[model samples]
Target: MISINNLTFEIGSRALYDEANWHIKPGDKVGLIGANGAGKSTLLRLIVGQYAPTSGTISMAKDLKIGYLNQDLLSYHSDKSILYVAMEAFERQNQLHAEIEDLLAKLETDYSDDILNKLSDRQLEFEALDGYNVEFKAHEILAGLGFSEEEQKRPLATFSGGWRMRVMLAKILLQTPDILLLDEPTNHMDLPSIKWLENYLQAFDGAIVIVSHDRYFLDRIIKKTVESRKGKLTLYAGNYSFYLEEKELRNELQANQFKNQQAKIKQEERLIERFRAKASKAKMAQSRIKALDRMERIEDVDDDNPTVNFSFKFSKPSGRHVVTLDHISKSYPNLEILKNTSAIIEKGDKIALIGANGKGKSTLLRIVAGADNQFEGKSEHGHNVSQTFFAQHQLEALHLENSILAELQAFAPKHTETELRSILGCFLFTGDDAFKKIKVLSGGEKSRVALAKALTADANFLALDEPTNHLDMQSVNILIQALQQFEGTFIVVSHDRYFLDHVANKIWYIEDKEIKEYPGTYQEYEEWASKRLVKTEVKPEKKVKEEPKVKKEKQAPSEDRTRLLSKKNKELSTLEKKIEEQEISVKDLEQKLADEAVYSDATKLQETTRAYNSAKAELTHYQEQWEQLAEEIMELEND
Candidate 1:
């Protein structure tokens, strides 16, 4: 547990935290949210003692342990295996094991009681600390973070910065500190690893403070939301969604108060003017004016959520089919990315390509963008299909010497400076900010500039790879709104579920070296995929043998017909009731799939998916039975 009281942190003349106070209680799952420059990461650094507060206190429990994960860990490198690095969290256990090994080696030369006694002591300590299972725990955490068994054994130095960051995350998770301070922990993660981390954090026994731009991730795991805005930390009792609603309500209340105050001031001003004209009330007017001057003013709410008023347009519309891949086959050494995979991108299609990491989502995007020609396939673009490709590398492609406005001007030569600035305004770069050099911008700012450039190109088709990578929640919403209003075709690759759900009308995923399409929103695709997963996991049941039927005794035709009709009607009634109940069950399961708690947990998702699938099957069977019974009764009555 940690307590931050009246914290005032200043960087030069600007204060990031001005008398901000927050208490992170034991077992609290807090989501630290704000705009990109609102000091979320800086607060994390202050909590971990990397940066000292200018005033006030950040106090922690005497025995409380904290683990902080930040982007700076990307610079970490080790020649040792990542598994070994992660297991280093068990410092005492590792030390005991080393001593025990040393003692065993000594025993080969001399069998003294002291040596034997030391070995026995070390072994006891190792067993007590559960030293033997350290490797297994390390391996599990590493694998969950997306490192394979073989990859875990590879030297940490061989991995890229993002992969190394994941290894650091694994190390922090293995440590299981009493409290965790994670800043953008989902930055380098894929959807699968992000889900795995969500489940892990949901079950974590310690307090957690996460600063993430991922809305879906925050909604899934965090119970409390803390917004860092205007140099103050405001707490919300619920998750990100709840924070948005609560903030809107507070803003409305503040706006009303401000309006009432302004009206009262105006009425008083008119009275003062009248009183000043009369000698008798001049003194009273003077006193009232002084009181009014001393009164505290109410500040009106600022508009934080800016709307995207700029519409995206292209010079010429593409043909019906924007792009086509004919039997595309691409492979790398010991890895088959895609084989005989064929797909089409229509002019109006808004596709979201998503899956786990190393699944070639980016590669396929490149193939569609025509950036890569080494793959064996006929990738054809429809007539008038002008395309713009945006990827992480585009950030590096930006000219460091040019201003943001100048950069846009160069990328879109046809657009006037006014039009380019208008597009930049939608991306949150205002009048003077647009004139700032690209080198002076932060990672998120640079990403916004790059995104704005991509949108400005008069292309009918867009292939965006991780376009929301460094954007804040507000910026992401802007991009979402722009894409929603876009009239051209696009296929985007992103791991942000919330962004995808809002921007994509169709889902594309690669499975077994083939591209699969789900013609619905991301949420719909997830529910369907869950059922498909359950189906694959379930085994077939053996057929039971049926006994020979016994013939009934002969009866009067009228009586037999009446009895058969009655039986059929009763069965039909029962089937109808069952069908109704199954429908309810299916609806309930669908609701559960939409619930954050159910979808965030693997066990719950699996259980709910299985139940949903079963309910659907039962509903089908009952409907069939009802129809058969109804037909039989109709036939009997007619006879």
Candidate 2:
């Protein structure tokens, strides 16, 4: 378990965290979330000792181990195979294997009992460490992360940064440390790989702190949510969805209190102003003024979700058909991407191109955008169609020397500086942030600028590939709103299910080297696809006799059995009463803990938490006793 108490971390003049406290208990699954500049990732680094906090303590058990998977690991390169890299996590096992090999070689020449005994000991240690399964685990993890068996054998240096990051994640997962600190683990993952990871993490025994923008992924995995805001950390008792609802309620309460306090202040000010004009009431007015000064001022709640008011600009409308692909056949030396595949994109079509990695989603996007003409295909554009293709590579196309505002101005010459800055604000760049050079911006910031350029273009047909890569939840929501308001057509390739569900009206996927379309929203497509999979997977079962049934005479209870059943019923009744009392006690303690007044007081919160847990344990004990007695009674009555 890791405990972060009264933590204060500062960067230059800015305090990223001030008195932020979080306790990560054993088997705790937490989602760390905040705005773009809110310091979620920085806190993770502080915990792992990569960055030292300005003050306070982050203490963990002496024997505890941590495995961290971060974006910086993308730069890690090695000529060794990915399997070898992942197996490196088993340091002791690998050493024992090396020793065993050395001992075996010496024994071949010496044929000595000492060498034999050492070899036997090393082999036993290796077996005890489960060293033989290390390779299998590495392979399994690599495959789950979207690497093929052949790919696993390939050198780590051969893969791109994203794929390399997956290898690093595999290595961390293979370590099986006491805790995992994952920063944007789903960043480069495809849908299948993301789902596989979700399943894997669900079964992970250690604690996890995941910082991700994927709402669905957070909801599926984390049991607790922590928000970093204004140099303070706030804990939510539930997942992302629950946090959203709870946050809204808290905001409403705070807003109401603030409003009431402001009204009280205004009333007090008016009374003081009137009374100050009279010499007789001057003393009372002064006393009221002092009281008002001493009163605690309630801070108003800040708006977390900003509205999207910027509509995309388009010069002209396209014809009915936006894009048409005919008999497309694309192939590499060994892998066939598309074989005689065809698809059509019509006006106003919001298509989500999704599938497993290496399924030609990007390749198909390139073909559709007319960015790639090497393939054998008949690709045609509609009349008066203007197209803008947005991809990760476009980030490299940005001018590093230009300021954020200047970059947008260069892309959209028609827009004024104020208009460009306003556009930048929608992407989370505000005030002095827009003046920052593109070279200094983070990957997510660069992504926002690129997406801003793409949306600002005078194009009616857009081709977006992984547009939500580094965006936060709020930014993604802004993009969704912008896309929903736009009249243009687009085909986006993203693994974010939440973004897809909101923005896409149709789903496109590659299957059997051909383009397939489901003429429905992403949610509908998921339901249909899951039902199809079930239909294919399920087989009819033949009826079989379950077991021999008890005879009617045997089912009749004897006098001794009846007495036992009566005794069990009495015990079960008493247990039911005790269980009810304990349940009420637990609920009372829970309600007390839920109160802000109680929770804000450390001693009260601790006492209530302990009492709640004890009450819960007592209730569980009574329920178990009741179940056992009820089962025994059922058996006795049957006999």
The number of the candidate with the highest TM-score is 1
Residue pair clashes in candidate 2 = none
Q: Model 2: residues >4 Å from true position, as ranges?
A: 416-418, 538-639
lDDT tens digits by residue: candidate 1, 535-606: 557623311222222123133456767887888778877877888888998998999999999999999999
In the order shown, what is each candidate's alpha-carbon RMSD? 12.5, 16.2
Evaluate residue 279 in candidate 2 and report its C-alpha lDDT on the 0 to 100 scale: 97
TM per prediction: 0.84, 0.83
lDDT of each: 0.90, 0.90
Candidate 1 vs. true structure, TM-score? 0.84
Model 1, position 544, has a per-residue lDDT of: 23
Least well predicted 10-residue stretch by lDDT in candidate 2:
539-548
Per-residue CA lDDT of model 2 for 507-612, tens digit only, reads: 9999889898875688877876776577546523311242334354446667776787788778877887888888888888989999999999999999889888
Clashes of each: 0, 0
Task: Judge candidate 2 against the unseen true structure and give its global Cα lDDT, from 0 to 1.
Answer: 0.90
